[model samples]
Target: MTIKSLSLKRKKTAPHGLSEPTDLSAYRRIVVLTEGHTNPQKAKTAIGLLRFRGGDVVALLDSQTTHQSAAVALAHDVDVPIVTSLADVSQPDALFVGISPAGGRLPPAMQGAIYQAAQQGLDVVSGLHDFLVDDPALVDIASRTGARLIDVRRNGFRETAKHASFREGCLRVLTVGHDCSVGKMFAALEVERELLRRGADAKFLATGQTGIMIAGNGVPIDCVVSDFINGAVENWTLANQQHDYLLIEGQGSVTHPAYSAVTVGLLHGCAPDGLIFCYEAGRTTTKGLDHVPLKPLTDLRNLYEALAQARNECEVIGVAINGRRLGPDEAAQEQQRVSAELGLPACDVYRDGPGVLANAVVALREQVVD
Candidate 1:
């Protein structure tokens, strides 16, 4: 059913917490090292940062795809050069390990390149589970060269007693998804842009490494201790208290075997006024774990709404479909099917614009007032 048809009522209280936005200006001129993996699906961090970050991305280091532009490889029409080695890059402030391989391990062949960057006194940034700072060789090199090794996944945790404080007049909308890499961040960003274009006081809150790189301020929620996951979210929300709308980026899926905790934590953390459920069309199961089948749209909606209502009243305002893999006809058909099944506005935010979901948020806000 549509959000208006849902029985949930809005809570009149604000969540409690403390948060400080991150500073990304230090990463002004960066060299993204993708090496063997340079495709969009694999080099998500590199592509995202290059696409959204306001800083100057000097080059994308990929030996195999040297001489080709980012537009050719990722099909995004970015002007950054793809170089074979760091020697080809000009003066850069940082060297970012931009690919998240299957096991999150640093590629063996790329270690020498990282060392080279460290030797040159350029800051090194990595988002893998394996922390580069922990490596003795890299640590020693960075210490000697006066370069900093920033593990985005591990660094930046401000221990605070403050939790998320729900703001009275702000409209907080979170983007939830069926699985990781389902375009939750992309949808949330587009929605925020659309809201701003409509003259709404909207703000986008980043929750992951790529988003943090883009927004210049956000907590990598998955890196935080489990005890403080929700607390981190609440604190981030509280930081944007002045905004009329806060479009918070969501993490993993509730059904994901490995990352469900992050999903549930974010859900309760933001205590959003509304949610936009994101799903990738033509995907029936979780990535990597083929055994876990994706829950149907109706079941997924019920699960999200039930959990949200248990804490504070919330509803699934609309559906954002990621139709990157599907043809136009197929995407439209899938969108129509999902809308009919869930009885909610459904569209691909990237292709169709975020108007549908943005309209839903505006309508909901007006409904609350009336």
Candidate 2:
């Protein structure tokens, strides 16, 4: 019951002569491996955009039955390719990987395969959420390999602006996750009000719950995601309704379909200047810790390097913190570590709670205008 098995059946076969890849020298392809449909749409949009700009993309999507099965699926996704490894991927132009915490330190089999790939001289880009890596050994591997390991949750704050510009003088912000993060919601609203008070036309877009709330917060929980997604095209189509600056908020883990659908829709519609990823640093589900602790790639200088591989079309801004209080010191330290690892200014919402961040957002908006 805990372990779910999944096998992919290519809906359609590739064209004959085209079945065997030609010289990839001119075309750099990217293969995206994921656990199920949760964020495949989002991952696909990102992968596609990056490829369209130049690189080639090959996505190997998967569906893990239980959350615990994510690692298993990732292991398979990676190893399967090695078993049927590409002829020219040996010297790939670049490689990107999205790792979930449950997938826990790439399985030994996959690690061996990766080592082999490295022997062939392939540099890989990998990502992790803040809470996923508490293990020292795994972090070490990322460091030595020179892999771009990132904490996806917060890659939005500092890095997103590269993709979508903020209103000349407005705040560029977003709320992540599809499930309601009352903490993040209130924080965004207060920031908006503060920006308006300062005279900036701060534009805000809500994905999933936040979007539903924008249409009207009383939305039924059951239809939350569908209503938001269905209404998105119409909402975006409305002119004069657009703001000089844009901020999008994601609610829920990257593994949720709502999260995937909304993010993909946003990218397909009007890709944000940047992506802001908010995660519960210590938030735990029945499946254990939800975030991947990526201790590796700490010295790479910012998560942009890793995100560039995950989704290059947009700049990534990351915000990380432990949503729960284990201890004041521990929470603060975690925030510091996350910020340090990503090479961005850390927003320790836990210290002053949401109020301080709300105020800080106001200050950031003002600076943006200046």
Candidate 3:
């Protein structure tokens, strides 16, 4: 993809309660804007444009990848204002707009506004693709608006592959569970980091970021691995392909609405080799805990039995702990409690030293495939 193809500069809505002008000014300090989600190659091109211009980049918005869109994937760390209208945008020294797959031509009223903005000397730039076959009125408006259009999508994926490389056969670990846990996604990342530190290659296929709103309630965890799930049989059919084991994570009550039962259903369809359950062992963030009947292990064990029932040969691993900081003795006590309650050999991720997570994974690997 050429620099002109990303609709990075287009104005869009900012998330609510973020309308302070100071925040807007902070975003305007950057020059290039890439819109929507893009694959790695297209994302790299957008980054390159910013570097070449010697200006900071502001990702326009997130959406268009698997969960939100490719925009979130490519613009991972950049500051983006969830914009609702162009009026919220501060006049940048220059603007580079990224087009969506359908192309990002402004409608009549928007085009007229841009034209007026151009007359006042805004250097507007846009990257739109060649596939826009309709909307002459919009095209006519853009023509009058003097917005420079650049096409950038061709060969973007190939260029992206330059940065993409396969792992050295890591134990693929997946995190699944409750929808309401505040820092559970971080727990997944911690698992990945722990495994990688112990020389296990870990690939994290997550629904979205750590925060709840970004991840959204009722977001299908399968959406995270939809493409991989669809292509699994074919990829397996490629005899020369290296085989990497998968670890699927799920949360909430197995019966909770936001729980990953449906996601687990998709994995059952793909048929993975093992599953891990990460659960909160302490009081939940919700209220009325005193009145609720809570038999944590009984609830978890029942869920495990159901999961094991539907699968081919698959080993189940149980992980439990409170999120609060604990002393060494308290930590060890919790570990023993979980191991006994779950009726399986378990290790405290913290107390068994940092390498315990890796050791458990290796032990599980030997049981399942070795």
Candidate 4:
């Protein structure tokens, strides 16, 4: 069956002045839309869903690279076939917008594809700052077809943090970064998995679009206003306090000129018990900010520690390296160099399993007698 002939059970995933669970698990066969963008950074949503969501993601929609395997470009282990249109794929439960453009604007091609998918009775899921529900044309078609518009970032802006602390005895860790897309979320996800495997009550707190989509629920902190960013983080942390470990995903670099506010806000709001410093192996400049330079792990560790001290006492306990650009031997060497210089265990979470970082967490927990 190429086209879905049934009506979608339209429901609001975005919490509008009300509390609701965000779950994307009901979508069994999702078609990831990343037309011209299939790279690691540009198509992060698609890549993340493929790598983490596993077999639920059926195909990648990229007309520019039709019939080509998306494994290499997306660094995915699965061979997600690239197709041109909705008809090219089988019965899709939903069409996922899998690229985060600078302005959150959908490309013309993706916009048309999403519309067609909705008209065909497939629910549309988006992670962009631009909510698809606002478009009358798309909404009208979806309404007529009984299809839902799932905007992941549309939730969690109505909160205002009255305090900036992760309640008492909350064993939470935050991933600090040298730059954006350097594997903070990936490392956090892996670490969460490892922690759970060890029988700990671990929860991965999603703070971005990709994380939100993968985890099915999280506050899109980047879309939050300056005054309420801290509150939003506080809100989510409070909700998940019962978990033994809350692995909060970090945002952009503190040195990043464009996204430093969210970084500092999370640092203050979460007041993490421990911090994991994530950095790319061979990058000297900030992504998309050519004029800005990325600081070394030592420098970032010191800065993050200092910033966290204002609200809570915490230390950077481990190093997670994003060595995607380097080969295995080179990545190993970089990890060794980082461990030696920083006096912390380091690993490329994607290249290696989460054992190293998880061990570091256990060490910290034991050392503190928690």
Q: Considering every candidate listed, which one attains the maximal TM-score? A: 4
- TM-score to native of every candidate shown: 0.88, 0.39, 0.45, 0.92
**Model 1 steric clash pairs:** 14-165, 14-166, 15-164, 15-165, 15-166, 16-163, 16-164, 16-165, 17-163, 17-164
Better of 1 and 3 by TM-score: 1
Residue 334 accuracy (lDDT) in model 1 = 88
Candidate 1 RMSD to the real structure:
9.7
Worst 10 residues of 1 by lDDT: 9-18
Per-residue alpha-carbon lDDT of candidate 3 for residues 1-370, written as tens digits (9 for 90 to 100): 2222344334321222111111111123333333443444333334333322223443343222343322355544442443433445564444444322222343232344334334434444333433111335433444555433322211111111111222334333434343334233444444556766666555333332111111111122322234343243223212212435433334344444443444454434334344555555464432223344434555645664566456544555545354345677777787788777766554544335325444566676676546
RMSD in angstroms, all models? 9.7, 19.1, 13.5, 2.8
Model 3 compared with the native: what TM-score?
0.45
Candidate scoring better on lDDT of 1 and 3? 1
Better of 1 and 4 by TM-score: 4
What is the TM-score of candidate 4?
Answer: 0.92
Off by over 4 Å in 2: 1-172, 177-187, 209-211, 214-242, 257-259, 284-313, 318-322, 350-370
lDDT of 3 at 13: 17
Supply the global lDDT for candidate 1. Answer: 0.79
* lDDT top scorer: 4
Give per-residue lDDT, candidate 2, residue 213: 20
Over 1-83, each residue of candidate 4 has an lDDT whose tens digit, in order, gives 32244222535333233224557765778899998898766888898888778677888888786446778777678777888
Q: Candidate 1 lDDT, tens digit per residue, 273-361? A: 89999999989988888988988877888899998876677899999999989998998898999999888999998789989999998
Those runs of model 1 whose alpha carbons end farther than 4 Å from true positions after fitting are: 1-22, 155-164
- Best-first order by TM-score: 4, 1, 3, 2
